[model samples]
Target: MADPQDRRPAGAAEVLERLGRLSLRELSMESLLQTVADLATTVLPGDLEASVSLLVRGSPTTVASTGQLAVDLDERQYERGHGPCLHAARTGELTMIADARTDDRWPDYTPRAAERGALSSLSVPLDIDVDEQVSGALNIYA
Candidate 1:
């Protein structure tokens, strides 16, 4: 019989198991988020990079990132005030750009991100709130 773990997606089990072992009480929010960003890149099939974008008091900030590309792309979004990551954080909706070069949803963002070598992107909203004023999203790029 095949092990159930084999049926699961790549890195899913590892990420979940690692997360389960975390001492949430001991880690700061920034540390926890950084771990999540790092874990995200491991699950995807390509050479991916990730970042954690937090929206606080209507401003967006990159709190943690796995690489410089992730941070640069995230900042591009923040500069425009609307991009996959920011949209996901603000709306709690998942945003995906299969190909940044052709994605026109964010005319101001996609082109620049593509120029910077981020050909694809995925932003998953995080249901995290801090003092009723914070929202977040996990952003992945490749």
Candidate 2:
């Protein structure tokens, strides 16, 4: 049986169109994050799940997630205090784990991620002004 979330990869044009609509919506930060997560799962290839992790008052919080899997994965990293998403949020750098099972950097996280059926992950830091203390990471799991 096929996963219901599986679908054909979206074209660049379609992705752009969906993003453009985001600008027109009167969405709050939470709403915007949800929209972004939904769009990511739809536009990206592979059996992907998406989530947004935000650092508020120096604590990691999952502001939005496409599904429970995303929330669970984020919690795994938060509990261990290390993972691709946490690294990206702190350093403002893109962190890609091509194969979670083989990734030696986050020994504790890799195994848990693998158990969740996440073979790979990509975490991108959301750009924020230097004056703003807020930090965020956009996490994709496959």
Which prediction has the highest lDDT against the true structure?
Answer: 1
Please identify model 1 stretches exceeding 4 Å from their true place. 1-10, 130-132
| Candidate no. 1 TM-score | 0.89
> In candidate 1, which residue pairs clash?
none
Residue 116 lDDT (model 1): 85
Distance from true location, Cα of 123 in model 2, Å? 0.3
Q: What tens-digit string does per-residue lDDT give for candidate 2 at 1-142?
A: 1243565677878978988888635888898888777777777777778899997656899999877888999999999888898899988999999998899999988998999899999999986547547888999999
Instruction: Pick out the ten consecutive residues of candidate 1 with the lowest summed lDDT.
Output: 1-10
TM-score of each: 0.89, 0.90
How accurate locally, in lDDT, is each candidate? 0.85, 0.84
The worst-scoring run of ten residues by lDDT in candidate 2 lies at 1-10
Per-prediction CA RMSD (Å): 5.9, 2.8
Measured with C-alpha atoms, the lDDT of residue 71 in candidate 1 is 90
lDDT of candidate 1 over 30-100, digit per residue (tens): 99889888777667766678899999988999999988888999888888899999999988999999998
